[model samples]
Target chain A: MLDLHNLRLAENGVPHLDSITASFAPGTLTTILGRTGAGKTSLLRAIAGLAIPDAGEIRLDGADWRRLPPWKRPIAMVTQQFINYPHLPVLDNVAFPLVRRGEKWPAARDAARAMLDKVGLAAMVDRRPSQLSGGQQQRVAIARALVKKAPVLLLDEPFVNLDYKLREGLREELVEMLRTETGTTVLYASTEPREALQLGDRIMLMAEGRLLDAGDPRAIFERPATLEAAQVVNAPPINIVPLEIDTVARMGPFGTQELGALGRDLAPGRYRLGLRAGDIAPGGPHRARVILTEVSGSETVTHLDLAGLPLVMHEKSVVAHAPGSEIGISARLDRGFVFAANGALISQGASHG
Target chain B: MYRQKYLFLLPGLIALTAIILFPLIFTIRVSFSGWDVYNPGLSWAGVKNYVRLFEDTRYWSALSRLSLLAISTVLIQYVLGFALALMVWKDVHARRFFRVLFLVPMMTTPVIMSVIWRTIFHESLGPLNPLLDAIVLGGQPWLSSPGWAFAAVMIVEIWQWTPFMFLLLLAGLLSLPSEPYLAAKIDGAGPVRTFFSVTFPGLAAISVGALLIRLIEASKILDTVYVLTSGGPGEATETASYYIYIRGLRDFQIGYSAALSITYLVIMIVALTIIAKLMVRFLVKGQS
Candidate 1:
């Protein structure tokens, strides 16, 4: 178990993280999702003991890590920039930590070779780091980290540079490897929602140095605590619209009427309604003009201008929607979310239509 | 396209031939002749000068001392420079100060530095002798003694050139990618293992280049030794160039001096060739 309590980090006198408290279970992949400069890397570095926090307690299996030096910590971090020693042969680089601990050269070499073989880089063991390609270098770095045999694995954007196929493949393999082989506590950070959703068992949503929410991946994505969380966890963004509640009118099924007394403030007043891109259906109640359409090979995303608001929807098959074409759009209310203008989620039985 | 480029190079080619090739041919011809200021004409001496060069004890001794001076200077400069570079590489605080301090010796004029060192090594009034006298050590004759004079010359050579090595190696160290060190650190490598397995090998090219430059510079050492010792005491610090100067200017043995100069050039060329071969081998092995 890894726990970070009241962790606060500041850079150049500016606060980057404010009292973040979280725990990551053993043998689980916990991904932190955030936009650029959201303190994701900073948080990871702080946890790994690379960057010191202003005020915090980092404990691994109940031992305080803040009191220990980085080398003494049982955490291994892989930064975005692959740090492979260019002078040493690939095998030696992987085996470096063991050799440092007074392991003989032959024993270190054998261990390094085994780790390199696991990463599918056995043949390049004798070559220098510079001789390998970018992907290969990243793999070597991973192998080196594994050779350290640290309990906590912190990866900061490890597969950001890789192509989609390689990224997916590595993600699957890495998750499985971490799960079966080491039972290492993995903290992976990425800005990509699909990657976070795919890799993370639990997702921590961050925005502007604040933890908005943390929960299981499915719950976090399906029911974000805040609009910011929703925006960060879904690609192409969740479509949001401001609407005034008419209490006298009939409420739709699974609509704002279910929100009882809380609908009083929203009565005949402005409220933000959110519908995920995936929740906006093709053949449903409303009709709108097809403002634009972008076709991706696997899925097609379309932008619809409805009620003077733009709503984005994703479809599994390609949709031929030309600009200015009128199209019917529908949404399953249960699958959607509604929030007050102040950005608070409208709880069921407390909001009006 | 080739014709136009060749036409542009024609004048440079002709000048190179006249300035470099022609003089080289003349020097080779003169090296074979028995010409002097008295004769003012050339006569074929053939292998006599070469044989004479081998037979001359003074010339052989000078050559041997030159070799020692070159080796010692190269070794000392490389070790001192590499040590300084490593310190500068690792230390964050006082790095700029140390860098500038190391370079001060290199920046000083060789003649001025030699005069300064000579004053410091003065047997009676020099600071070094007084310090040695106070430290329970006997003050030995520096420039006045044969052995001390040779050692003094070597010291001066090392002090002047070590900074050059430091600068080159420091640049190499700075240019190296930081990834390997980080990787080594991640692998739990201690400082010593990391240095030997990673840092030293990484700085190999720059080290070799610095050593080669020092070797060449050491072989041609003239100004400092000339100022400090003047081939002094009893020919103890006399180098090939110093001997050539003595024979050509002082003794008026111009033919023999020219012969000695030719021999010196050949020896230097052979030494440079061997160093170059070693450098190439190192590069090839590194690549493979």
Candidate 2:
């Protein structure tokens, strides 16, 4: 396991990463998910030694890995940009990492050709990066990184420059490669929540230079450690409502909220209710007037107003509702998270009832 | 619409023909005839001026010297300037100070630089001599000797223009895509391998660009040579441009000088064409 202990990086009197501590298991693919300027890239850079930590201990199997220089470390990285050396052929580009290791030219070329073959780009080995499409160039970059055979692989938004379909297809292929390629700890950084959910075996959600939450992809999203974590992990965003509990009843726009056993024991005070879009099914006891509807991919998300407070319901089916129509919206109460007034996840959104 | 477009081009075309075409035509006319500006007799002399130009060893020597100066100055300047650029481009302390300091030489007027260097290269009493004397190397007449005079002129040229190359190359270095460098480091590439594989290849265009500008400018340079050496010490430092200046303007051998200028122009065309070809090859090497 690669363990990062209290990793803090400051630049220009401002902290880029604040007390980031996490452990990445061997041969596991983890995605660092965050919004722009949320320190996802900074955390990746720190791990790759591009930005050294201000106060931290990076240990690789109990050894101080921070002592190794960037080049000396066992690492392979693919940047977010389309990067291929403009003066070298794709074969040479793929062979570059091996050549840097003092390998002979012809041997490096053969190894690179094999690596390219793995990326399904063997025929275009002689072609330059510019001669290929954006997808092809990114494949060449990946081939270059994979050829290094580093134990640690870091990808910083590598598919952000590509088209949506390309990103999706390449991501599937990359996850497969990481699984098949043994003993490599792969960390993919991206701001797109959908991408993180699609590709990450485990997801690390970072925000404001802090690693907010981490775990299995489903667990993190279903029960984020905090309200901010819930917001970053869910696509189309989660609906948050103010809660006022007094004895056995909870006051808020969510009238039919079932906050499990904790709901009865909670002090009669203010709190926040978190509901994932997928959990708010249509039809229960509470009624809401439809405000808008958005259909994307296989799911249709309907926006509704509950007593003037807006909420959204994500349904797997392509269901449509007209504006101003009153519909019964049910919260999968157990799938609804309860947060303290200060935004900490007091009760996880699960079958606690 | 076509007529309006043509009308809009009328003034510019007229200006181009009058200001540019007329002088070129007159020069070409004078080149073919042995019409010395000193003598009033003007008649066609066939290829006599051209043949005489080929026979003149002094013109050939000047051309050779100018070529030598161009090649050596460009080579030395590129290496020194690129090294300096590399030093200041990375995380160097006081990088801004060094950047401003390096730019001082290029910012100085050529004439001013020449005069200052001339004083510095003065035989026994100059600062250079005292510095060399302190290091057990003195008593060399810098501006009085043939070889040393050429060296002094080339030195002044390099000193004045190295900063220009440095500036252009620095911009190129800074604007390079950071992805490749990051990829290089992660790939276990040492400094030398990374430079050759990534940095140098990426810099190919700027290198050729700086070389082209410096080559053309240095080949036809005359001011520094004129000020420092005055084409003296047995005509050792007489560059092609200085030769043309003396023949066409001073000696009034207008026809011969005009013919010689054509040769210089042809050489420039051929040299620039070669450089451009290299640039195209470089740019197309790893591109679509």
Of the true interface contacts, each candidate retains a share of 0.49, 0.72
Give the range of the ten consecutive residues with the poorest summed lDDT in model 2 chain A: A248-257
- Ten-residue stretch with the least lDDT total in model 1 chain B: B279-288
lDDT string, candidate 2, B1-288, tens digits: 467888889999999999999988888888887878656455787778889989989998999999999989998999999999999999999999999899899988898789889899998667898888889976577898998998998899999999999999899999988777877788787688688777887888788888888988898899998888888777989999999999988988888898899887888799779877876686535332
The prediction achieving the highest TM-score against the true structure is 2
Candidate 2, position A36, lDDT:
84
Clashes of 1: 12
The candidates score, on chain A by TM-score, as follows 0.84, 0.86
TM-score of each model, paired residue for residue = 0.85, 0.87
Query: Model 1: residues >4 Å from true position, as ranges?
Result: A246-270, A281-297, A300-312, A317-334, A348-353, B1-9, B86-101, B125-140, B190-192, B276-288
Docking quality category of candidate 1 according to DockQ thresholds? acceptable
lDDT of 1 by residue, A1-353 (tens): 99999999998887888899999988788999999888899898788666889998999899998877565676677778867776668887787777676788799889989989988898999898889987888888888777777788889999888777777777777776676645788899999988888888889999888898998888777667777887898887888755557754223332343334434445565666666787777886677889889987678899988767788988988878888988777764444566767787763222212
Taking the tens digit of each residue's C-alpha lDDT, what string does model 1 give over B1-288? 467988889999999999999977787777687777676556788877778889899988998899998898889888889899888987579899999999999999999999999999999989998898899897879989898999899899889889999999999989987866665555555477667767877777777777887788888888977899999887999998889888878877666777888889988999888977887577434532
**Reference contact recovery of candidate 2:** 0.72
C-alpha lDDT values of all predictions: 0.80, 0.85
